[model samples]
Target: MNTTPDSIRHVALSTVRLPLAVPISDAKVFTGRQKPMTEVIFLFAEITTEQGHEGLGFSYSKRAGGPAQYAHAREVAEGLIGHDPSDIAKIYTQLLWAGASVGRSGVATQALAAIDVALHDLKAKRAGLPLAKLLGSHRDSVRTYNTSGGFLNASIEEVKDNATRSLEAGIGGIKIKVGLPDTAEDLRRVAAVREHIGPDVPLMVDANQQWDRTTALRMGRALEEFDLTWIEEPLDAYDVEGHARLTRSLDTPIATGEMLASVAEHERLIDERACDIIQPDCPRVGGITQFTRLLTLADRAGLDLAPHFAMEIHLHLAATYPREPWVEHFDWLDPLFNETLETRDGRMILPERPGLGVTFSDQARAWTTDAVEFGIR
Candidate 1:
């Protein structure tokens, strides 16, 4: 086989094993849930060009079942070997169709998403441009919201305290978790938080798929007096009709789709007017390439794009999209990464460095144990 510096050469994939305890506090959970500790699995892909430039990307598996996620990543990696790292879209399309028989959504798409991100990272590095600039330079800074310090297990007082602290930290917006033992009690907690934060600061609430449509509508109406920014995932994630009903009945906007796996699902939600704001998690969606497409879809539909998590990637997407209001910030897993995403005055500055502009620290690597590498050509 012949290879040139600018030509497709070899691709290597590896798994960096890192374990995270239950209750990812600073986002949701206050008292910290009991045992059955959770481990975060990161799928890292290194794409090498004939020129010797290597690009890196990562995927996370945080569910109770790990075998399936591991297998999915490995299978996708096999298809990515020998593909040009610069052809990010082509590779993504190939992996997307490779799993077509099983459907191009869910774990399969998520697996592909990780690989796509790594390829984009590599492509950006080769081009010597930040991912945001490569995508489209719309803004130099991206606004952010605090997803930490919400603590579902914390007492009302403690929740208030955390909210106050986040405000003091200069976050323009804050998200809190609801849907507890009783709807009435949940409303009370939300009301107390609203009172503490005052009316000027934007407030969003997430139910984490805990309530049904009726409950969501009732709660939405009840919380109208408090002026919530949005009610997220109030029903099952796949329940587009339920979300539409809730959106129609409530004064507050309905926000869902973080669990969504494809643009098709998002199109359905947007076409139906089910959600006012679209929240796509880069890892859960199909990475940056697809995310840029999704942003376009939302823009045409006149909907807002506020990414779910992965602030590092979201910051870039938000900076490129221009209409994205905020990127959710939760620092639980950041320690495992090499670089920390900077946030100040409720905004994040898009890194000027090439590619994703972030690296995984040795300290973060210490969290890894067993490893698996793939994509050798």
Candidate 2:
């Protein structure tokens, strides 16, 4: 253990399982690409410096691979025990090589997401500033939208009700899942929701990458009349060329990139001008350091930003974008944190608290399935 005055002294890891209220389905599930999602698994990292300065960060997996992230992180996180706490990027590189044999993307980097995020949180907390301010922010709040209430599993009436509730709750936009096998039914749901929310509200639709080229174009054209803010993931996430074709052929904007796990992959989409809006998931892309690299490219390409989930971590990231941006709102993670995010006037406000401004709730601790620690506390 490091006895140096400013070096890292303690590192702890916990695997927590959060069970969903219901098994949620999207276009991918209906198409048999994957099963419904029943729970979200998190790999949390808490680091303490010798001076008692602390930071908390986490990464998560869905459907499968929870144990892989935990196991991988367990093997490599100890490398941080004696390093300087403020050298975040350097520390991430060290961990990368510590586990180089397993490769650098997917589960490998995803596991490192917790440590990277925690280091940022620790540094920000030490500075006593909100993460956005520490990173340099452009706005105090980002445009907000909701996707949890409008899943494909819900009925048309349920979709309308969810949209109404979300709007009444002060959210500025609504997003609903599309890409059902039955194209007409998808249109019917869009039409009903559009009518319910009215033309003034900004509405987006996600296809979850369930469409082929022909269907994506056809559906994109048909969706134009609804006045959609954008048509999301109409084709596969990897179909940059196809997305470029659709981006040109249709009036509605194309949005994708959430499924991609590395900044290198997003660079291809940005350089090719594949989509109008680029959505990235921070935890999926190896946390804030990697996410910050992506933001620079996205800002240069002038692509609109709307990160995919974990609004707690993304609100700060979105606030730093040079352009106006949006953040997805899902109550799914609310049970895991002690605090609630404020939404009003169609935006999610930045927290004044240091770091990510979140602390794990008792429910989160109760949900911990495994734990490990290194160094003296």
Candidate 3:
């Protein structure tokens, strides 16, 4: 390892599994299983420079397989040693091709996402600036919509109560899960929640890619009266043609892309005019560098930004988004991190602390199932 403080000397990967306080469900909750636990994996990466400065980053999985992602992260870290922490793009390219045989998405990109995020965190920390400031701040805080209260498993009354509580907490936007077995029941839920939240509060719904083109159109059209912000993942994630057709048919915008893996795929979505709101997840999309490319593309296309999970990471990215951004709120992650995300008047305030500005909780550390490190001794 180089003696210089800026040189990359070591990388560490740690894996932790967190169980959802409530077993959250969407339309596709049971892809095959009759029942499943709502647990997720948090894979964290810390890239340390020779001077003892460390940059933190992480990725997550709703499904099982933390070990596989951790293994891939370790493999990616091996090739990153000896490079400058500032070589994010170069290192990103190297890791991108290294996992090409496994395709550009999935576990490989999840690993690369960790590296890219940590590198950016490292860079921003070295500059001693908030990530958004380092990336060029566009807004003080981004608007946030609460999704934690609207899970499918909750009753209609529970849904209304959740919405009311969100409003009481100063959050003005709320999202709920739709695509229930009965369309009427789904409409009823939407109606009840909308009524509870009132006319001005923005409401959004997600089908979790459970519907085909026809059903998405029919249900989306019916639910339009509720004045939704957007209908997310109404069709399959890859059904660009279907999404375009639905997007054109509906007055309510169709938002998707959380399942998407690369900038190329996002380009296809944008080029096809698949949806009005582009929802990209940073860890799922190969980290901030790739996400920023999509953010720029979305901006040029006149599309809105509403990134999916991991609000801690997206809060900074969205704060600097060229357009006003809507970040989803999932309090499910509160137990996983050291810091609390400050929210006021329906918006999230970014932390001024250096880098990603948060660390794993000691309780979260106790959940670590596997840990590994790579670099010079």
Candidate 4:
């Protein structure tokens, strides 16, 4: 670590709301559990050290709670003003304690995530190395797949068209939303997508925790013929025992954990042998610090890794996984950054640029709904 006092001199936080082209409906929306998600709310943290080094990181929420994350971040970010930006784990603990009243997981950890990630980005930038290189990369590229194109809102034709375009663009796999109320409809959609993409391409489906055990099993069996890569979140996120049972019963690999907010929650899934693949979202699991901890545990259990979102950050983190990993490709976030990630032959190539390999675009600033800052810069 750089011993120079290059203390974090400023922390600028902003809330950017990115609108989807259309209302995104998943199983959650169709099940009446939540309304269609029209936007993704982000808490962006831009941290600067006294030495002039800077880093940018962001966390996001879907449907609601954007304000709460921003408010919580604003409250705790003050503590980072004089701290060495390289002491990521220590600073993460301090922020967690700063907001101890709200407990350690969910929104509290999520809010801290942006700060945690920003610190990592700063440390990597200061070293003049890409974040993946800073973290010890296992590979420069990770298998990539597209999820933004495969939502329940789109019809079979739309889904097929999206898959065709995505493949042409170099995405390696296709994943479509499943678990609509009608099982037959879900099957028909999956069948159509499989037929369109052909069996040679990787295909996966997400249930978004909308299915009961019986339904998940039945669908799991029915979808088996398609030779899916994995079935994601077929049961509730916390249903470790349920997931374990389903995992044991199905030949298809089970993937979950994006909804988990902390390392301990994921520990349950890893300990109990719940799933074959683990999909931890960096921001949602409290940024790279906690996400790395989960990766160690998942690796020991011999589980496959496929980080959920935020390809800008996950691309670096996933590249470091001991085992080859998959990074989800969502073009929705493409406009937020001035640099774009490349996908070819179904893999996301880690950017050679230092830190998270991205700089905020003017559009990101234009979408800012709120902003706050702490300390001098």
**How well does each candidate superpose onto the true structure, as a TM-score?**
0.89, 0.98, 0.96, 0.98
TM-score winner, 1 or 3: 3
- Could you give the candidate ranking by TM-score, starting with the highest? 4, 2, 3, 1
Ordered from best to worst lDDT, the candidate numbers read 2, 4, 3, 1
- lDDT by residue for model 1 over 120-149, one digit each (tens)? 787788778998888886888777777666
User: For every candidate structure, what is the RMSD over all alpha carbons to the true structure, in angstroms?
Assistant: 3.5, 2.0, 2.2, 1.1
Top candidate by lDDT: 2
> Cα miss at 28, model 2 (Å)?
1.2
Candidate 2 stretches greater than 4 Å from native: 1-5
Error of 1 at 151 (Å): 3.1
Candidate 2, 91-149: lDDT as tens digits: 99999999899888899999999999999999899889999999999999999999999
Winner of 2 and 3 under TM-score: 2
Instruction: Report the CA-based lDDT of candidate 1 relative to the real structure.
Output: 0.74
Tens digits of per-residue lDDT for model 4, 227-294: 99999999999889999999999999999999988899999999999999999999998999999989
What lDDT would candidate 3 get against the real structure? 0.86
- Residue 354 in model 4: lDDT: 93
